[model samples]
Target: MTTPAQRQTALLVSVVGAVIVALDGTILLMAQPVMQRDLGASVAHIQWTSTGYLVAVAALLVIAGRLGDQYGHARLLFVGVLGFGAASAGIALAPSVGWVIVLRVVQGGFAAFLQPATLALLRLAYPADRLGKPIAIRTGAIAVAAGSGPLLGGVLVAHLGWRAVFWVNVPLAFVIAVLALTVRTPATQRGNSPRLNVTSAGLLAIALATLVHALADVPARGWTAAPTLLEFLAVIGVATMLTRHERRTTHPVVPPAVARSVPVTASMALLLVTTAGLFGALFRATFHLQDVLRLDPLDSGLRVLPLTVLMVLGSPAAVAAMRRYGARRTAIAGTVLVVVGIAGLSRLGPASTWMAMAAAFAAIGAGFATVMVTATGTVVGDAPPGYAGVVSGLKQTAMNIGPTFGIAVAAGATGTAASTMGSTLLILAALAALGLLPASRLPRRPARQEGEHDTTAALPAQAPTPQAAPARHTNS
Candidate 1:
């Protein structure tokens, strides 16, 4: 029952939210060197600015998604956008490195709320058959934000001052907030009214924090450090306890049955691998471009333009590919492209040409666009209606974790930055190759026909009852 104008506004809001999230990831890269010099920080301390953001985003995403479900998505979206903007402003005005880090954590927390709500809003706003176009548009926006952030950040940091990089979000957020007010809330209702499980949330946060600490310390202390080992063990133990507690709770954070589903598990795995490669490449590429290639921040950002452009260009084709070949084939094809792209990048040396790197980025960007679109569709399509928030949260979590793990591994690789990048790219390529294994197992067509009676009557009353037969393959 949504009006066309309403849908348009909703799409705009979601796109803006997504762009902000993407910018959050890449914008800081350009500002890092400047901030370090101004704040008189060590390399490790500067790196934590990005790490802290990732950790905060990862830890809070699920809880935020649930809050959107319990409260209202539109409301949460507004709050998140405003909070994010404020935090950005704080970062812009901060005098001390510690203040900047604290503000980044705030920005990440707000981002957590914004991201999942955007996805939930999209899922609610569009019908199933027509979802492709909007999702494609959303993917395109994310690519643009991510691809442009470095360049934009570089320019801002060099010419305007590093603070300008953050100030930019304030105006953008205002525009998005105004547009957001015009959108209609979806008709979906939460009947059970699940409350936030404080204990579970706390435990999960601690687990992630511990993991990040362990990862950060591993290189310096090695695996034998008593504290690192203890933190690792604590993370496992806390996570195990959280899982058990959630499973027994009447209203679990992530429902046990849904988490165990093949589609959900597979989709999460795809997200983890794809994001790890994409973010890892971004991190390393930025460093290599600036530190090794002697490129200015602006130049470094510009170097990644090919990747961004290709992602935008490749989105529609990816959607079409999904429709024609089914999710499995489309995903596998994308993964192959990612593998090729990473392998190509693995060939980079100290003397590699800019054109060579651009080509590598372009390949990776295309692959990333394809896989991201496909993986998102597959995960959301397979989720039960009531659990969309949780599914989206899980996707966000995987996305965050992927980058964190990738950076940890890549940073730890032996040799110079160029050599380490080569090795990391190869590892990423292997991960991309592994994606084919799961892609092969996805059902090639819809699991249900256009119209069929429900067979599983014992499912929860609130769950959407399936009323269709498995869609038959036309060829078969």
Candidate 2:
């Protein structure tokens, strides 16, 4: 039987691995200047530090999430943490930029193993009705880690040099890995494992990769351009084939239940849209802050902390808000706040104070936290017991893809930095405003009373679907 203390230990362990994975995405950007000089790497080569890792992570996410579903989440967490630590150590000691990029890519592949599993594991950790604060906390941790990356990178690079950033992850990964080994594997992890639908998995990777590449190209080549349009078309065709193949296969990578779930599907859309708007707007605003306002990198990084801080604070606030407003309304309210904040950002000007911008970012961050908590609780809460990892992976995939889309949109919008950024922010506001579609679609479940402390409240029961594997599974 899963004990409460063991459950908490598992969640605690997962967060440590998640922090390192999240931090790497942005920390290396700050370290690039120092590393570029030290390693004699050209700008093109250095950019791969992020590009290679992210692409690998994106490509492997779906397959890895499925693997985590088949295997134990705790087992996947340990192995991923171990590999990530090893790769981080390798990158820290690398002699050339090429070697660093290669190691980073390896690290990214490992990093992919962390997120979906961690998300899936969270559902197991807390009961459905009690999951809001934990989800908020998880989302907040990721946002804080990503938000703090640059500042932390700047500091480490300033003092211990760029290598320090990778070194920092080593001990963290080590601790998490050790803790993961101790978590009692859930009953599902002890039985015979099923094989992944490799063909379906491959198709998903190709489709996702093509879509991401197409999105990345949208800035330089307009979306209507031949190559961009072709890529989009390619994604559509692959998606069709993927769906068809999955339907025929007895063991589809993404089970029919998960793919067809309204909460899961809708939440994934919101995840993608919200992240795109949130991160995309943040990127453009950073450029303005750095170039127009002439703030140093650290200061520019610090300015965004309001977003992270408020996001973190939103964890505790989620329960009260959900109690008063319930999940669907709370999510809608949060998304509206995101839209309003992006609109607030569009008003940026030469005279705009950093404090004012910080406040605006804070609003966006809080909204992000709320949506994440509400949507995640409902989606995961409603998932059939056996497929939490699949749903979690889809959610992570959306979040991962969101920033790329946002960056592409920001890049494609033509104007002076100020004009461009303002337009981009407005575009993001519109996208965030679209979140109401999904938010409104969220199931109108009643709320738990604020004074309720129960974690054993049973989730709303779901009927088993044809695609659902037996609950007894093994760590394959």
Candidate 3:
């Protein structure tokens, strides 16, 4: 059994790990232009740094999660945090842009290991019924990290230079490693030995990589472009192969049990569709604020501050609402708010006041936070402990793809920013409205029996802790 102290420590490590990763992602956006100039790299090369990281993380998440399930979440978290820090240090001291690209991808691989472990750690620490509050706190922490990223990046890049942005992660990683060591994760319950299907892993990786690449290419290369079409075809073909292969394999990448959970599947689908519409709307609004309203980047960021503020506030509130109302009602309410926010955004014109804009942004942020807390809690809470890592991996995968997919679709809408902005917002809002289908399918309340651990059907009731071994440290 996990003691309260250990649970608190787990929460701290989860928040810190999540913050650094989210911070790095957003802060890098600010430092990119500077890094390009400092490294004397072409625009495409600079863009690849971010793209490479995204692809690496997206492709390897499920595999990493499986490792966590097979080993221990705590063990995987330590290695992941340490490697992520080491990769950051390499990027900080890189002699060329090429090195930066390679290290970023390596860092992303570690990040994939880290992300799923965060949720899995929580799964081991907290019982299913008590998960919502912790998830709310985590959601709020992410909002804070994302909200502060640009400002923090601006400050770090302005004074310490672009390298300092990366250098900052080293200490944060160290702290997380220390905390990880202290937190005791419940031993994972597995049979004799779980065999990983290497061929299935490779196929899934290729399919996700191609899908992300195709979407990423959409802004620069139209849908009909040869490379884009070919990548999409590759994704379809590889996915087909993976499905057939998975059926025949005794040890599948995604277990059949996970695939059959209606609540879990619906939650993942809701997250993907909701984020696509929400983020797609945000992408278009960013351009409109700058191009049409002629607000400087700082001013535009300030106008959107309400969204961050509301998210931070709304997450905890969502937990209370969920307890009182239920996940389905809460999620549906949140979706309506998003639709209202989008409708409000569609009405904005050149003469719109900053308050009007901020109100709309706030609605979107608050609504999204509620959906996030509810959906994520549902996914993690409903998952069997044995499969926590992979379920978290699937959740993260949907999240990673959603924003990219949204931005690409938004970019594809025809006409100038001014002419197409309202129509695009409306289109996104309509798509978000469709999210109700999945939201309706969510559990009305916590589904697990009180005091019962959500364990897999085949897993043993009691797990044996592995023999104490020296912590394996990786050299940077």
Candidate 3: clashing pairs of residues: none
Q: For every model shown, what is its TM-score relative to the native structure?
A: 0.89, 0.91, 0.93
Q: Write the per-residue lDDT of candidate 1 for residues 228-308, one digit (tens) a residue.
A: 789889999999999888878776777654566666677678878777777666666667777877887667667788888
Which residue pairs clash within candidate 1? 449-469, 452-467
- For model 2, the stretches where C-alpha displacement exceeds 4 angstroms are 189-194, 217-227, 449-476
Per-residue error for 230 in candidate 1, Å, reads: 3.0
Better of 1 and 3 by TM-score: 3
lDDT of 3 by residue, 394-472 (tens): 9999999888888877887653368899998898888788889999988765334345443333432222223211111
Candidate ranking (TM-score, best to worst) = 3, 2, 1
lDDT score for residue 281 of model 2: 87
List clash counts for every candidate, in order: 2, 0, 0
